[model samples]
Target: MESAFTKYTPTEPQIPPMCITLTKFLTTRIQETYNVCKRENPTNIKNCLTNPFEARHNYGLDNERNELIVYRHDIIGTFNSFEGKEFSMSPYTISRYEVIEKLGQGTFGQVFKCYDHINNRFCALKILKNKKAYLRQGLLECATLSMLNTYFDSNNDRIVKMYDHFMYCDHLCISFELLNQNLYQYAKERRHIGLELNDIQKKLIQLLEAVECCSKAGIIHCDVKPENILMTENGELKLIDLGSSCFENYTLYSYIQSRHYRAPEVVFNNRYNNAIDMWSVGCIIAELFLGVPLFPADSEFDLIVRFVEMLGMPSDEIIKNGKIADRYFKLVKRTNKYRLKESFEFEWENNIKLPPHKNYLYYSSLHDVIMKNPMKLSLNTKENNFIIRECLLDLLQRILVYDPKERLTPNQALNHPFFTFKNINDITPKDFYEWTPPEREFPFKVYGHSVSADPEDMLSDAFENKIIINKKLTNSEYYNVFFTLLQAGHVANITIDNPFEYGSITPKQFIRVFNHQFSKPSIPKVSTDVPRSFVAQIYSVTDSFNSVPIKKEENPLTIKHCNQSKIIIHRMTDNK
Candidate 1:
């Protein structure tokens, strides 16, 4: 599609209306030119003035012949004494790029879709404005791009890759890999319909990975709204626009991030870290699910109020640390409690007439907002859908934490339960193949790996359909295993050859063997209930816990098995 800006015709330069007066200022200079069209021999041109100022007009003087001699196209373009901030049009070449059309415009400069003659491919050429401050910012963008493109973005897929950068027509032009529409445009094209849960999950995984990459480089992507994330044809997201980015330790601006996605620390002008990006990520995820921004505010004050409504009030410590906290909050002298200053009262302090607060729909917490969202999940059962929502909400709560120090890091979010397949039925072939196993933990060493007693690291994906023996399972864990197995198609007989001296088994001794021989295939579900006689043989009649077990009186619940389509576990043997 053509840009909204008027196309500049070669015959008439599309200068701004305000610049029209400059033509009269340079009229005397233009009149000094000789009419080459009226020469004794038209081929032999007479002296024509080539003053820099006359170039703004498309043609040289033809007062005598009253016809054009030197067309604007005849002269070679130079940077010296350029008039407007942007290049005129395509059919124009800047260095090796053949400018096709204007793609976009930002504070730094205008971006054009150009043909890279050398590479024989299309690229986005970002040409900085011919102004000092913009040029400086553009150069900084180039440096950050150079660092990321060289060291961090080794895959060339996480972030928008920069190809070449150079000065063209006195503008610092940086060429980047051309990508599809940004996320904002993508959602808009879909009429603001929320994305599918699976799609949102996939995008979040990639987005978090991208953010983690940025964190590794110690660069803060000061602006990370939907507009800054571009979707490839395959639907993979690539982060773009790091013009406002700065090193984590050397943040250049207190005012950063889009209003809706802005972190609280930024809103209060407090010291922020990489956690600010996580907050933005949380907002984006919420928006992706709701088909709109999580917090759409007309002003910073409104944004703070939304934050308060959606995520409770910030801790006193957090508010106290804010550099500009006094602008929005006042410390009560008697109680030392911070109170939100009224918007009208701040008008005098800031010398700006502030609008009255708009009545906003209130949510007790982010959980309430997410629960209210009409999210459609692929799960067949409502219970499964609710489970997914709750898992996602847990992750978002940590990400949207008011305190930067307590907010979830990209690495931590990657490990959140939402990304893991808690249900066997939810496990896709893709999920299995792409699954990364966490470090294992057990009381004793297994598979040449060190052992730890920590219960948190003990459970892995393979142990989802686990068997608990003398060790009674908690209600939550028991139900989790039951539901997981209930979804499985086949039940395999798991036999234990030997048990400890006490003739008892515990989860800590449940060695996870990655042997491929014990592949479990899904078949059909077994009966939900069994006779007491049948239950007695499989499970020990224990008063402490209520669990169904397979009958094996001689065997003391030694083998823990999973009901799965492909359950591969090798039997563990003790060394003599």
Candidate 2:
């Protein structure tokens, strides 16, 4: 009998001593049991002896945790059972909060007023949808909100306060202080029947104070339109909608301003800073007084034109430093056909038109309407032509300057006499809200709602409104291709009529001919170091003044200086 214990030899050297001791103890017990049961039955004694060892082995196997511990050889010492920590439910996740009403939907989220169940407070909860398309936009909104929340955390009265942010499964909830209504709705309701000058001054002061708060924090509310300015129930002006806002040092690669209130520098593709906000503030002021946008052009180009029409074109020196100098200057329409050939002359009566609306009656159209006006309060009291003409028109004109750098800053506007009133802070919210107008009942239905109005239609309308001006200006046959090349900064000029050809040519042949005309000057050097032949080949394809066929071998040497010059000139000349 080969022993069954032979196969059960200790596998680990460290456990050999313990295994031997256990085996000895088990054998002694088995021998005693066998001796006691020898007279009864030899087979029964053998079975009883093996059964004790087997039962002991089975008991060790029954404890899985203990078995793993024993396998680790106790090198890690004693094992303690782990218990998970208890987590409390988020306050927002509770279903006890009462939903009062929906506020308005933002670009990627919807806002609603809800009563907090935990705190029993009224708060506005902005629910952000985790949609794939708006992921980046949603992130931007969160970043902006978090930044603003940190900055305004200390100030409670002047700024809208962010209460809490909670995550419920896939949704993110942003809680903020509940406010009454935005200035857009307020202004729309009170159009025509303007607020009393005293009340307006009070509101302006509150707005200025809010501006001061932002400026102190080194923030610029890039989007300062009426929709972003909110009115508290107390009539205090609070700046809201930090989604389009950024720090003073931040520069958005793309423009992020409302079209109507966009600064001229922004419209012209110029790099802008805090001054753009001032321009928006001016637009808001103009809207408040005149009941409409100051420069309501049909398109961006038209808007720029309207701005220039009101404030006059910027100086060449001003244009050069701006980002749009290379691109926009070429596109700006020149209307100054009245310049004198010899010396300067002024003819005020025939050239100037009476300032457009009733608002112009208080300011001089010439002095206060554009470049010359510096947004100051009208001091003239007389209703005579000179006084009436020198008052509001001039004041408003200074506010609407095309050059943002030249426009009145928020602080500067605050100090102006227009805002100088004894009881400026005394005006309450009830004064502005309670004094209702007849127009309050009639809301203008601007955007039509229909299932047919899909994203394609909206996109088409946007493209038509934004790009049609450029397209219409470039109506010549080669304008599209030529303009594209020009935008890329090439130096070639485009002519409508080819001096070498009399008949109309196809676009391909036109390119070939154009390429041939501007062919590079022949390289005189024959040194192998310069690759003169390769250079010449490259110049041959790119230097053409007409459309020309290009070969693969000559591609490396082709100068293909696309006619960026033509685009610039076309842009300059096309601004009708």
Give lDDT tens digits, candidate 1, residues 180-221.
Answer: 998888766755444456666778888988887787766679
Compared with the true structure, model 1 gives a TM-score of 0.58
lDDT score of residue 379 within candidate 1? 40
- Give a tens-digit lDDT track for model 2, residues 1-576: 877765555452234322333554345334333433352565533333111222121122112111110110111100110100000012212222345655766564566677766567887766554432232233334333433444433456556776554332123445678888888787777654544545556776677666655655445577778887888888888877665654443343346688878876677566565667767777776666555666665554455556555566667655666664443344334863322111111113224323332233233333444323323222332223333223334445555676654555566666554554364333333433333222211121111111212223322322221111222221121222222222221211112222112211112222333355574211111111211111121122345444333344322112234422221112221121
Residue ranges of candidate 1 with Cα displaced over 4 Å: 1-95, 191-193, 356-364, 376-383, 422-576
lDDT agreement with native, every candidate: 0.55, 0.43
Clashing pairs in 1: 489-523, 490-523, 520-567, 537-551, 538-550, 538-551
What TM-score goes with each of the models? 0.58, 0.47
Give the Å shift of residue 558 in candidate 1.
Answer: 76
Cα-based lDDT at residue 225, candidate 2: 80
For the record, the alpha-carbon RMSD of candidate 2 to the native fold, in angstroms, is 29.6
